[model samples]
Target: MDILYLMILCSASLAAVFLIIFIVNAKKGQFEDDESPAVRILFDSGEIKEKENNGNKKDEKEIGENNKIEEKSE
Candidate 1:
């Protein structure tokens, strides 16, 4: 039927468009460093005591400051 033909054509056109976009992105090297993000995460030292972790960072900072204070007091 004509309706079936039209549906098939629409699906084929969509598939072609998606394939073309993927090919273009591939040519642009957009996926070349996909593992760099994972590697970078693995290499992090977790030493950046962020301030928004609900008082933990503040407590650590206070502890550090207290050590310096105690050092000065000594």
Candidate 2:
């Protein structure tokens, strides 16, 4: 049917547009940093530890404040 031919042409045009976009991105070094993303997880543990330390410090400060308030009330 004529509608089938129209659908085929539309799909082919869409595929060609996507292919062109992909080729442009590939030439621009968009996919060059493929290793850093995988290895970043290994380095992020230090940041997590730092955040935990900061959180512990905050908790200690809050407890100290609460103790001071209790002493004042008593």
Candidate 3:
């Protein structure tokens, strides 16, 4: 009987801790973007790559180097 009471108290404390953590996260906007993340994986990476290739955008390294050179010139 004593062991049963101890187990109940332990379980209740663990439940309260988890509940507090969930409430804190919920209040902090952690759960706000739930829909976007689920849908984001459905987007086609191949389509994104095709768009990037069509744009002829400079690579990140070249862009960074160009910015550095421009800053030096100014």
Candidate 4:
């Protein structure tokens, strides 16, 4: 039927558009840094650990100050 032919043409055109978009992206180095994202988390944890250590030191200093205040009040 004529309707079948029209449907086939529409699907082929849609596929061609998607293929062109993919080719353009591939040429632009979009996929080149795939490894860095996976490895970035590994390196970021060290920075997070450093921050946590600094926070703990501040907490300990505050606790020591509170204890001193309590002793003086008693």
Best by TM-score: 2
Backbone clashes, each candidate: 0, 0, 0, 0
- TM-score of model number 4: 0.56
The C-alpha TM-scores of every prediction are 0.58, 0.63, 0.57, 0.56
lDDT at residue 52 of model 2 (Cα atoms): 65
Point out where model 1 deviates above 4 Å.
45-47, 50-74
Model 1 per-residue lDDT at 6: 100
lDDT of each: 0.74, 0.79, 0.81, 0.78
* lDDT for 51 (candidate 3): 75
RMSD of 4: 11.0
Tens digit of per-residue lDDT, candidate 1, span 1-74: 99999999999999999999999999999889878788887553425533334445456677778557756955
- In model 4, the worst 10-residue window by lDDT is 41-50
| Angstrom error at residue 62, model 4 | 8.9
Backbone clashes (count) for model 1 = 0
| Candidate 4 displacement at residue 51 in angstroms | 7.5
Q: Give the TM-score of candidate 2.
A: 0.63
Supply the global lDDT for candidate 2.
Answer: 0.79
Model 3 lDDT tens row, 1-74: 99999999999999999999999999998989879888988765657655765587788787678657756966
Total backbone clashes of candidate 3, pairs 3 or more residues apart or in separate chains: 0
Measured by lDDT, the strongest candidate is: 3
Ranking by TM-score: 2, 1, 3, 4
